[model samples]
Target chain A: MAFEDKLSMILTIGILTSSALMLIGIAAILIQGGAAGHSIKSLIAANTTVNTRTLTLQDAFSGLSGITAIYLGIMVLASLPVLTVAALLTRYIGRKDNLFIAISATVLFDMLVAIFLIPYLLH
Target chain B: MLLLLLVAAGVLAGFIGAITGLGGGVVVVPFLALYLGVPIAYATGTSLISTIATSTGSARSYIKERIANMHIGVSLEIGTTLGAITGSLIAAEVYALHLQYIIYILFGLVLFGSSYFSIRKLKMKNFVPGKADWSTKLFRLNGSFIDEATKKKINYHGRRWLLGLAIMFIAGMLSGLLGIGSGVLKVLAMDSAMTLPIKVTTTTSDFMIGVTAATSSGIYWERGFLQPLLIAPVVLGVLVGARLGSKYLVKLNSRVVRYLFIVVLIVLGSQMLLRGLGVF
Candidate 1:
């Protein structure tokens, strides 16, 4: 398959998976009337104290609660572009296209630093 | 009830954005901040996350159609990602200092500026590619795409990579600062500066925005701006609405729609500006 086709497939699968997880989260919230001990009303409030900074990945994966599912869904969505760039890097490396490999590597490194390193440093 | 309202707002923003080509962030940020009374930081953060949805959705098709120049998009991303990092940090500082009014004013200005360009672009003629410079050869900034309207293979090459890169950096900064895709500026860099074919420019812009937005959204996420309840509904609604709008775009009298949306942009921009000025 062509590179574009592979990319298209990855995006399709990634979006579908994320959307499904989010919907499942909404459903769980509605059915349970809350998530992680917070009421739905509180969770939906603009000034709600629950957010990424207060929640850990381990907490999100501890159970399939509404908030946790939504958190995981968002994590998946945010990682889609990184996954695409990684795929591109792998392809370029296979072809020994050093220039594109360097470019892709730089972009991937930037994303990783922003997602992981900066947050770690700031906190 | 709030969730439903948020979803409706997302749908409207995404639908308007797709049909007018102004992008969903333009609509999402203003409506959330001004109407829904969400904090500016949270509003922009939500818009940024939803932008990833629309970008990825559209870019998938563009890539398959082979109109998007991956070579150009990937190379320019170096500048955009770096700019996004700087912009996100600036936004963090601004929010921390309780100067959200700055973001409101800047977003309003961007809306006004992009509206003007949208109208001007309607009257612009096709680009005539100039001589390839050194940056073009070094970056391999050239590609060909089959035009659907003309059914002809149109070859195009980009020149002045440094200028394009510089503009892309600014575009990325605006994107992070305002939680927008800044597609208008990206188009400006590629269409006006790099002199690429419009098809190539637009598609590649779509392809690049996801990464640019992802860069900033990551930082926003860490800052606790990405509330799950707010983002989930908006992202889902935008993804669905953008898909519907793109399907109906050919049937709609887009010129009429564009003019209507331009009017909406002016109104929203002015409202945001006034709000920032404490007129409300």
Candidate 2:
């Protein structure tokens, strides 16, 4: 398949998966009446301390609760762009498009640094 | 009830954004921060995440249509990603210092400035390609797309790669700082500096926004600015609304929509500025 076709497919699948997880998470939160050990009211409160910084990905996955599902969904959504860039990098490498390969690699590298390195450095 | 209201706001922002070609992030931040009284940091985080939804949701069609130039988008991502990282760090500092007023003022200025681009876009027609310089050849910044409106294949090449990249960096910074897609600046960089086609710029901007937002979203996520409960409804609503709006975009008179949204931007921009100045 063409690169564009692959990209479109990746995007479509990513969005569908993420949205489904979010909706299911919401439904679960409503049905279960709470998530991540917090009541619905507290969870949705403006000044609530429950956030990604407080909730680890391990915790988000350890329980099948609504908040965890939503966290997983958000993770999937956030990864889509990185996935797209990685795909682009692979395609460019396959075609031996040196300039484009470099461009794609640089972008992917920057994103990885932001995602992984910056957090550690900040702390 | 709050969840429902948040969803409704997302839908409205997405609808208006789609029709206006502004994207949802522009509308999301102001509404969430100003009207809903969400903190600026969280509002921007939510807006950034919701932006990814709109970007990914619309990317399929844009990519399929081949109006979006992936090569250009990827190239530009180099600048935007770096800018996003810097901007996100700056935002973290600003928020920490309780200097959110600066962000509000900057966002207001960005909104007010975008009106000029929107009005300029209305007057723009029949793009003529400029002389392709060395950077264009080196970067391979040329592509041809079949214009649906004219049914003619339009071949175009970008110039001033450095200038476009510089503008893209600033665009990326604003996106990370303000939690917006910063499509206006991206479009301006491509449309004016790079001299690409409007269709190409708009579509390519859409393609690039997800990666740009994602770049900063990582920082925001690490900072705990991403609230799962707050973001879920907004993302879902924006995806739905943007989908519906895009489907109906061809049928609606875009000029009318643009005029209406320009007014909205002006009002929102002033409101944010006034709020920042403690006048509201």
Candidate 3:
């Protein structure tokens, strides 16, 4: 397959898998009366105030089997773009396209800074 | 039930966004914040996540159809990503100062501004680039795509990379600050300033938005705005809707999409403005 085809395949697969996980997690949450001990009503309330500050990574991982499946699903969704960019980088490297490599690298660097460095700097 | 509501809204937003190549963040933010009573911050966070899903999902078909110009998209991302970081930092400051109303107001203005331009440019004529300069030759900013509407092969090249880069920087900053895909601004930059075809511009912007949104999302996550329960359904709904929407885009007339976009922008813009002014 060509590069664009491969890239599209990667994106489709990533989105489909993550979306399925999220759907399962959301269904579980609704059926199980919410995740991490919150009731479904509270969890789904229009004005509910759940956020990253209120929810921890550890909390998300621990509750996936029980209630944190949604968090895990979102985690997958968030990471997929970065993964796709990485795929682009690898493709460029194989083709020896310096311009694309630089471009993809810069974007990846920006993503990394946001993911790891920014949070560390803030706290 | 509320989760279901979110999914339903996401579906509508995604459908419109994918067909128009606007990425749906524009709709999701206003729908959630103004209509659904979700806090604006959370609405933006959820919208950004959904933006990623829609962009990524729709981008697949756009790429396959060869409507997206990867050269242009990748070249422009450098400015956007850097601008996103700067914008997110500024956003953090704005949020800290409890001046989130500014975001609301700015969002309204951007929507209005872009809608006006889109409406003006809604004439179904294809844009013709005048000449390729040094920047075009340096970047090799040329490609071809089959226009589904005309069913003709459209050969195109973009020029004025400097202007496009500058506009994209602003677009990125807006994306980060407002937690939107900022596809309107990006498309305007490419379509008008860089003189790329509207279809190519829109699809390339769609292809580019996911990276920009993802870059800013990390900050959103750390800031405690990314709520998983809120995002899960939006992501799922948007991805599915965008896929369906992209399929239909091939058959739909460009003018029809622009008209719909104009209506959505005006309604959402007015509402956000009212909310910002405390009129509602």
DockQ, per-model, please?
A: 0.77, 0.80, 0.75
**Which pairs of residues clash in candidate 3, taking residues 3 or more apart in a chain or in different chains?**
A63-A68
Question: What TM-score number comes out for model 3?
Answer: 0.96
Candidate 3 Cα outliers beyond 4 Å, as residue runs: none
Q: Best candidate, TM-score-wise? A: 3
Runs of candidate 1 with Cα error greater than 4 angstroms are B16-23, B248-265
CA RMSD of all predictions: 2.3, 2.0, 1.5
The DockQ-derived docking category for candidate 2 is: high
Q: What tens digits encode model 1's per-residue C-alpha lDDT throughout B1-280?
A: 7788789878877676555445578888887888788888888888888888877777777788787888899999998999889899999899999999999888778778867876875575555797899988899999887765556778889999999999999998998888888776887788778988766776687778889989987788878778789899998998887777655543544246547656867888888888889896
TM-score (all chains, Cα) for each model: 0.93, 0.94, 0.96
Least lDDT summed over 10 consecutive residues: which range in candidate 2 chain B?
Answer: B246-255
Model 2 lDDT on a 0 to 1 scale: 0.84
Worst 10 residues of 3 chain B by lDDT: B121-130
